[model samples]
Target: MKTEKEKMLAGEAYLATDPQLTADRRQAKKACQLINQGDYDDEAGRNAQLAALINFQGSFYVEPPLYVDYGYNILVGDNFYANHGLTILDGARVVMGKNVFIAPNVVISTAGHPLDKVRRAAGEEFVKPITLGDDVWLGAHVTLCPGVTIGNNVVVGAGSVVVHDLPDNSVCVGTPARPVKSLA
Candidate 1:
């Protein structure tokens, strides 16, 4: 039998209230709290906390008030910068390549509840991985939904909701984000 975490990672329906999942989320929350309380000048401390919280790699700057669920499922590459209020519901994996810039109030969620009200009410949820390639920029308030794969050098406009895979070197905007132009 698959563990709850295993099921979650596999994109299979799982119980969110499972003890292990709850503990993981609590640990992530504690790390976020510590980071949020630390001084802005204490870069090392903040980075350490973030490192303990997630699968962070290379160099990165994350302005706090950040939140995550199962931080271990997130992987960010070099030269990443995220402004305030960044939230990642990484029930499944979230991978980001080098030079990714995220503006304030941006959310990347990998967990999705079932459409069936009965199942949703029962706390059953599934996860899908989200990926962002190198040199990607997300404007303020942008929300990247589950299973989104944004290509390299792409720019997502502010307040946009990315619901589908975006092509490389494209500029996307508005709800259900559509490619407005190609940079290539």
Candidate 2:
């Protein structure tokens, strides 16, 4: 069986050196510059610019200054919009579904270091895939942990630290991200 550390390293290496990754990084940088500078207000222009940052299969939208480490590991769906300072550390795959809205300072991270002292000190890596389903809304400063999945139409409150799976149409808040109510 492949160790978590080994898997993480392999994934990171692939992202850091792959040709597609390099190109995607460049594209992300350029798009960030444009977004931060307040260029590309038109729908067509914005779409064209954002096309390079992620594997966007369906229609989606993003606000400016979007930052990501290893952009190639992210995929997005239709009508997705993320506000300013949206950062993703996609050491593994991160999938966002249709009609997703993310407020400012939101972070979707798929990377983690080891918990053990020796492994942590040596920078042993671990990663897990993150998934956000359709129509999900993440409030400002929300942090999504590795391997967590937010199901369709769920709403995560501001400053929430999501560390577990949130079921579809649920309202989740607080540090550990427990469901407070159901919308379904």
Candidate 3:
């Protein structure tokens, strides 16, 4: 039998209130709090906290006030940068490639609750991985939904809600995030 954490990571429906999951979330919350409370100019302190929280590669910069459910489920490649108010509900893996830039108030979420009222009331949830390819840029207030895979060199306009996979070198905008133009 799979544990709740195992099921959650595998994208299977699991109870969010399971003790192990709750403990992991608590740890992540504490790390986030420390990072947020640390001085903005104290890059070393902030990066140290983030290193303890996630699997980061090379160098990255994230402005304070970041939130995550399970920080261990997230991985970022070289030269990633995000402005303030970034939130990631990383129940499943969130992988970002090199040179990803995110504007303020962006949300990248992998956690999703069941649509059935009974399941929702029971606190059952599932998750899907989110991927961002190299050189991707997300404008301010962009929301990347579960299972979204944005391709290389793509530019998502401000306030866009990406609900589907985006092709490489595309410029996407608006709600539901249709490809407005191809950059190829």
Candidate 4:
């Protein structure tokens, strides 16, 4: 028998209302609140709170108004920078490689409910991890869906919704997010 956390991490359908999962979400929310409300000059306080929540490597800078479901599921590499209004529904792992940059109002969601009405009504949901390779940049209002892998040196345009894997060194845009320009 697997716990809700284990099921969620394994990409299996799980109930979000489980006690331990609820507690984890609460902790993440508290950390986000502390980081968001911290004084701009008090980088140490903000970083301290963020450090306690996420697994970040080397250096990172995240602007206020950031949100996450479970901070422990996120892993950010060196020189990661995210602007305001970044929301990560990290039901599973959200891995960002080195030099990743995210603009304002970006939503990276790893959790989704089943298409079946009964399952959705029962609060059954599954998660798929999202990964961003090194030197990736996501523009403002971009939405990265579950199971997406943005390749290295890729630049996603503003207001785009990425639903699939994007090749390296490309510029992508649109609803389903297809590469429009190849930098290679």
Q: lDDT tens digits, residues 70-178, model 4?
A: 9999999999999999999999999999999999999999999999999999988899999999999999999999999999999999999999999999999999999
lDDT of 3 by residue, 39-158 (tens): 989899899999989899989999989999989999999999999999999999999999999999999989888889999999999899999999999999999999999999999999
In order, the Cα lDDT scores of the candidates are 0.94, 0.80, 0.95, 0.95
Model 1 residue 28 CA deviation in Å: 0.4
Model 4 stretches astray by more than 4 angstroms: none
Clashes (backbone N, CA, C under 3 Å), per candidate, total 0, 2, 0, 0
Determine which window of 10 residues in candidate 1 has minimal summed lDDT.
Answer: 48-57
Q: Which stretches of candidate 1 lie over 4 Å from their true place?
A: none
lDDT of 1 by residue, 1-184 (tens): 9999889888899999999999989988988988998899999989988988877779999998899987899999999999999999999999999999999999999989999999999999989999999999999999999999999999999999999999999999999999999999
Q: Candidate 2 lDDT (Cα, whole model)? A: 0.80
Task: Please provide, for model 2 over 1-184, each residue's C-alpha lDDT reduced to its tens digit, 9 standing for 90 to 100.
Answer: 6544345536542224445545655776776676567655576766676676579988676777788866678889887778888999887899988889999999998877767788666655567899999999999999999889999999999999999999998999999988999998
